[model samples]
Target: MITSMREHKGHLYPGGISNKRIGVYELPDADISKYQRPWRAA
Candidate 1:
């Protein structure tokens, strides 16, 4: 359930969920390219 802000002209904006519920949620339609990796010491 990718929810977003619906403007007058039907504009959708991806947002975050506060106190995210387990049953209902929406995956933002955005770039999640960033990832977590172990730190490498030089």
Candidate 2:
């Protein structure tokens, strides 16, 4: 779910579920476009 959220920037915003449940696991502010590998696309 974390990967998927990061993929599309779908629903993983500040108030999203991941933030609610996993309070310590914040996503990094990465440049999604810089990822070249398929698995690292997001």
Candidate 3:
């Protein structure tokens, strides 16, 4: 199992996940645009 999260437009958004048994994969990078929130540290 896998889980991840990201911030976009000042809201917490779900990030993508991939599972492969016979292939290679990479985790997606976090989105930076409009990710800054007033209640969280930068």
Candidate 4:
């Protein structure tokens, strides 16, 4: 029974696993434009 169990365990497939790298970037503050509008007279 022990030998049969070992053989069955060996036949089992491995689970999915990945070793990928990810990159993140941030924009500079000076490059951003300001959104300002003049006030209209009432």
Which candidate tops lDDT?
3
Give a tens-digit lDDT track for model 3, residues 1-42: 346655444345454356432222334564556545454656
Q: How does residue 28 of candidate 4 score in lDDT?
A: 41
Between candidates 1 and 3, the lDDT winner: 3
Off by over 4 Å in 4: 1-19, 29-42
* C-alpha RMSD (angstroms) for model 1: 12.1
Output the lDDT of residue 10, model 1. 24
Ranking by TM-score: 3, 2, 4, 1
Q: Report the candidate with higher lDDT, 2 versus 4.
A: 2
TM-score of each: 0.18, 0.20, 0.27, 0.19
Error of 2 at 35 (Å): 0.3
Per-model lDDT: 0.39, 0.41, 0.47, 0.29
lDDT of 1 by residue, 1-42 (tens): 544442222233444466353232344554334534533557
By the TM-score metric, which is better: model 1 or model 3? 3
Candidate 4 shows a clash count of 0
Q: In candidate 2, which residue pairs clash?
A: none
State, as a TM-score between 0 and 1, how close model 1 is to the true structure: 0.18
Residue lDDT tens for model 2, 1-42? 443233433223323545444223334674566655565534
- lDDT score, candidate 2: 0.41
Candidate No. with top TM-score: 3
* Segments in model 1 whose C-alpha atoms lie over 4 Å from true places: 1-21, 38-42
